[model samples]
Target: MVPDGLALPDDLEGSRNCGLVALSVVARCSYAEAVRAYTDVFRSAYQRHPRKNWKGGTTWSLVVKAMASLGVQHSHTEVTSAVTLQRLAQFTRRDALYLVCTTGHAQVVKNGWVIDQRGAVPVEQHWGRRKRVTAFHAIKED
Candidate 1:
């Protein structure tokens, strides 16, 4: 399961904030809270709301720092392109949690399901099935 209430809230409108949405779902926080956490990392408070004035770019380093701010234990890794989103599930332990980043998007994968802007879906059926995994993080579940 994708975890209860992990889906992006309807109010989020879900655009240009893939990293923020993924962070919100993984940390089980409100979309507003995620925005706060993310902007706090780089002191970009002026553009707190993605829909309003978000700059629309989050690097892997920013994700790491933001996760830390939220007290979400995580570790980052760079992987080969051979590890497509589908292949990622194959190598992932069934009990592990991950925030998989592709060329320009992110998703939360756990227990063989992926939760993103569109809600939860099996890894194979995910919209980014063939998206090459650029980098990924192992999120320690509490």
Candidate 2:
């Protein structure tokens, strides 16, 4: 399962790489590995050297590139303005990790919880009131 061996950092107090952190856990690898993969994807796809702090933060485009580099297939769906816990539970699957995004943040949802650098918490608690879910990335097996 995706949750197996997945662990979060003790404190992401000052980190701006929530997307990378979530991707690392979902990819089951180290944060450095995730940064390397993101950089590789950026270089290969854009044909330019990524900024030194490219991996320090994330954007929607970067997330897509990272997912592609990690061999995870993804899709975008227009969700309603309000995504309740029940809807989230029904939208997610057990074997896959769901990369969810709101207005300014991204998180990994697995097994009814939000898996981020801080830790795994219920989706309702971490999700807050910003409910503009723009995309969903489903991790694929090797």
Candidate 3:
């Protein structure tokens, strides 16, 4: 049964789609308090995993899952200085950073904070092959 005002995502993978939906709702409602409460729950779920801290407690997969549960489908852009200050300011008393990416395609840096997709820059120009057509130069450099 649906809880009083609780809404469910169309997909059974509610853990994923729910977040995007929640974001939409919160955006429309401008309900930051409700949004924070929901996101806090998502963060708690993420921390439950045993390996959560292995990779700085910040894995793309877990971030995506947490966002999904909260109804945020996309990722944020770069992690910049200003963005860092902004995101740090958003942290609850709990001290967990909510991951928001710029675009849904893949993770990319934006501002200074690691948020969900907002806008994404193409990899072809900066990361694609130099003279090698199919080979990515960035990979070779590493």
Whose lDDT is greatest here? 1
Candidate 1 TM-score, C-alpha based = 0.82
Q: Clash number for model 3?
A: 35
Per-residue lDDT of candidate 1, residues 1-142 (tens digit): 4654346754576463788888887787877888788878756544565565437677767777888899999878899547788888788876778898987889888777888877789888998988889898888877
Q: After superposition, how far is residue 138 of candidate 1 from its true place, in Å?
A: 0.9
Candidate closer to the true structure by lDDT (higher is better), 1 or 2:
1
List model 2 lDDT by residue over 99-120, tens digit each: 7776667777777667666677
Better of 1 and 3 by lDDT: 1
Clashing residue pairs in all predictions, respectively, total: 0, 0, 35
Q: Which candidate's TM-score is highest?
A: 1
Q: Roughly what TM-score does model 3 have, to 2 decimal places?
A: 0.23
Off by over 4 Å in 2: 1-5, 9-16, 44-55, 73-86, 127-130
Ranking of all predicted structures according to TM-score, beginning with the best and ending with the worst: 1, 2, 3
